[model samples]
Target: MGLSRRQLRLLMVSGFSLFLMYIMYSSKGDNPSSLSDSRESANSIISANPNAKIDEAINNKISKLYQQEQAEKAAEEKAAVDAAAGIKVTEEIDAIEEDFDPVKELMQIRALAPMIVFSKSYCPYSKRLKKLLTEHYEITPSFFPVELDKHKHGKLLQEHLAKISGRATVPNVLIGTSNESKGGCDDFLNLHESGKLATMLNEWGNKKLSVKRLETPSNV
Candidate 1:
């Protein structure tokens, strides 16, 4: 028997609905299995490859090395900055030293007299030494008195004196042609008391006199 058109249409609709449900069910079932199969395949590959962990370890080591290299580069840059700053500071100090060269001033003073007395104007010890030398010994022209505090390069001179003489105090009495005498007030007083000061002055005076006599033209 032949079906009616409405009944045939209803049957076709039911069949189409069943087909859609089956498709949905098949998609849901296939997605999970496909995901599981992919996971299992990945696991099998990892198990077969013995060096998977070693590759991971090598990647981790490379990452660590990159980090260490970055850290070392930062340290080197910091050290370079510190070194540049140190050099600038050193240059500034050298410039100051050159500006106030005490040695040059000392040489100029030495040229004036072999016997030099480094002193300060207001110092009592300096006054005492000056009086002793000028009044008692009468060694005026050959005796050179440098008032350090009054001089332009006084501070630098003091620094140099401290280094050379091992004493930076006033009334630094330097005597003889060799300029060997390096002492303070006490040394001067001791020399005076011992009468060595008189003897030294006489000897120095005789040498000067002889030199003058030699310089004078002979009666030809």
Candidate 2:
């Protein structure tokens, strides 16, 4: 028996609705699985052909640079302490002969005097030198951090020391009471090796005291 037109239309509508539901269900169920598969594929690619080493190298260099800078700052702080505590400097007698203001001249002389240093933040030898000086002499001396040549006078000082004192190294040292010693880390070590560091320092300290006493006479 043939169906009526309204009955056929109603049946067609119901079938179409069922087909659309099935399509929607299939899409929803497959999407999650498809996404998971894609993620897994990407992970495999990364694992098989890793390319982030450049990033690691860059990061390592950055970290190393930061560490170096921090170390330098620490050394400078130590030096500042040493300087404030009184490290003597010596200048050429003839260099400032023309305009010798005793007050200012004395100040410059103190600044240019021989100083003992242990280490600079940027120099490895400076570390070793500092340790030796501390262990052998029990003095920290004045510290100088020659990392980037921030003090323009350092060049001139280095040149002067090189030309006059014949020593030109970051850890170079001058010892004795009058600040007359001119040597470096090697010299310090040599003195320690010879068991003369302590004796020399004592003698130098005595001389230094006497000189200062003479320089500043008492009313009595």
Candidate 3:
């Protein structure tokens, strides 16, 4: 067919517009042909290897077994670690028990003097009792003071003291060689006010153990 010049010019303009659109699409990375080629290649590979399906099943089974084996190994390792930790803890406890005897320790502390004051440094009542004993009275034998908070085995001592004395709180005042606790700070105050402390000290001692009251400032 013989085309007119105007028709040929219009056809060239349309062809140039189409080419521009294709260049824009290519720059934007749209590739349907590449996707189709990948699918064809995969199909060709599968067809060439007829036992591809069977091989895939065997690979999946092997992977699953490997995962289960790794999981079992991890579990066993965790159990072994926990057992070792438990054993170490048990051994440490046994060592402490072998080294420390609360009963024996308490007995030795009690035998320090005729009178012992098991106290905590921070307690208000313990402080008051200690002040009165140390500052006010002078006996033949000075009273022994044990600050429980300062002791390494303080908790064990306090527990054992509670069992023996039936009192858990501090400023635990005990008297005589038998470790007799008349009571804590409040009880001692009552005894001091009643003039019983002086008399008791004299009577309980091997010799005449006088609790000589010291002269101090009247304001104190």
Candidate 4:
């Protein structure tokens, strides 16, 4: 009871048409115009190359996936470029002459050559470190010292220093205009031990800084 070849062809075409109807029904909430165009294209493929409809469908899906991947890669590259651009944001700001801003004053002092030590007159840590810098190194431009206890806006400046540098204690050392702290007295000693202090001072002070003359004792 074998069916004729014409009858078999008719059955296959009818089954494929039912499958396409099921797909269209399932894509109900999607863009109607896009769906209509896809339906027309699928019909054209089926009409010209009856056996290739399944392959064409698979190829369309693969093409859509490739486009999505390319879009995601483009987004990631744009994010990377945006991050690089943000890295050059200026730390310095402009202000008026009459206005006495504590933060501005802090920036001005921190902007001094060689380095700046925001110290207290009575703090033994400050005394010891200052002595080391004066005796051991011939820093050309010389380091700037801000005696917070002697300043008019002492408490106010210290409060703001803590806010910016994240160091609340005496002997806060800033080696750059950006106010990047090099920690306190103990940290400075460690820098000397590691031989980075002399190297840094040479660049900032514009002179070859001398190495530690002797091992001074103070756990400040």
Candidate 5:
């Protein structure tokens, strides 16, 4: 029998709802497969570029190694520099300790004699002066010879002598007193050649005696 209009309308509405539900279910099922296919395509693309991951890993490892090597090298250089600095400081300290006082020694030597010869044993000029003073002159008692190379305060004395006399060599002849007269080998030779050395020595000797007399008390 033919349905009434209301029943036909209700039947049509139910059919349409069922059709919509089936279509939504089908779409849901297709979405998962589509996503899986997309994932597979991405994987295939990555696989085609096989060296990409390897290159990245290699670069990272090499970079890390390079940084480590640089750090080690820097540390070694710093250690070397520190060691060298330490050695230099130690040497400087040793030099300071070994240095001598020149002024005090010079004063003491000057008091010892009026005619002082600052000489080195091995120097030719010093030998010449010594020979001339000892052999040619009779001034042994007043002649004072200082062998600079053998003396403990030699270097200091030499430096001080250089500052005072503007000469930094051996065979430095000092006459009368420490600061009174200064001459080198050439001056000594000149005096000897001119036959004035003996006269000069006699004069200085008499001068020393006069100085002593002046210093002595009148009653004594």
Candidate 6:
């Protein structure tokens, strides 16, 4: 029983129409506005139609976007950590005086240079070092007691001296003579322990006295 060519053609057309109607109905059944709506629809279509290229495209885009965002976030977090690590904290200075002359002080006593001790009132090491200076040696007014908390001047002075002397720390002790400047509390202690502070002071005083002799005009 062979069907006529016209009948076969008509039957094929009907079947194709049914498939097209099914495709249209399935596509319209789900909303396409939100990601979740699209994802659910994609999943349903993929399960039913494994060879769907359109669903695979959408998934690839989503995965690529996720990876890019994760890398950017990781970079930002690393930058924050590096910034925290690189941060430097400086010691705070309270106040600076309006009229404080360093030159006049330096010139007096024929340049009888002071052992400048940068100090903070609450610092125990500074206190102990000061006590040691007083106990072991003759600390004159030239032994400048610079309080870092009381004024910024002390901190500035300490910084200036540090740069000139090639060292940086608190409780800094300096012995500036007519010709040379020696640094550090430990150095001073070493000299003092070795019975050298007295000798050095005497030598400095003698040098100043000799300098005065050179400066004065002899009554020939």
Q: Which lDDT tens digits does candidate 1 get at residues 1-220? A: 8996556745655565566445433433335457777677667656655355445545565566567668888999999999999999999877877887677777777777657889999999899877766555545455778999998668788778777766778888665544444577787677677657566555654454111112222221
Candidate 6 per-residue C-alpha lDDT over 3-42 given as tens digits, one digit per residue, 9 for 90 to 100: 9755674565556555555664477364488888888777
Which one wins on TM-score?
3
lDDT of 4 by residue, 57-163 (tens): 65565566567668888999999998876664432212222255787787677566557888999999998888777766656556789999998778778888898
Question: Evaluated with lDDT, which candidate comes out highest?
Answer: 3
Candidate 4: segments with Cα more than 4 A from true spot: 1-100, 111-114, 202-220
Residues 1-220, model 3: lDDT tens digits = 8996556645655565556455433432435368777676567655655355445545565566567668888999999999999999999977886788888997788677777889999999999888877787887678888999999878888888888877889889766655456688888777777767666666665463457767764222
What TM-score do all the candidates reach, one by one? 0.47, 0.36, 0.55, 0.46, 0.50, 0.38
Tell me the spans in candidate 5 whose CA falls farther than 4 Å from its real position: 1-99, 178-181, 209-220
Global lDDT scores for all candidate models: 0.67, 0.50, 0.73, 0.69, 0.69, 0.56
Which stretches of candidate 3 lie above 4 Å from their native place? 1-94, 204-209, 217-220
The sequence of per-residue lDDT tens digits that candidate 5 reaches over residues 13-111 is 556555645543443343445777767656765665534644554556556656766888899999999999999999986786466567777888888
RMSD of 5: 24.5
Tell how far residue 173 is off in model 1, in angstroms. Answer: 1.4
Itemize residue pairs with steric clashes in candidate 5: none
Which lDDT value does model 2 have at 24? 36
Q: How accurate is candidate 4 locally (lDDT)?
A: 0.69
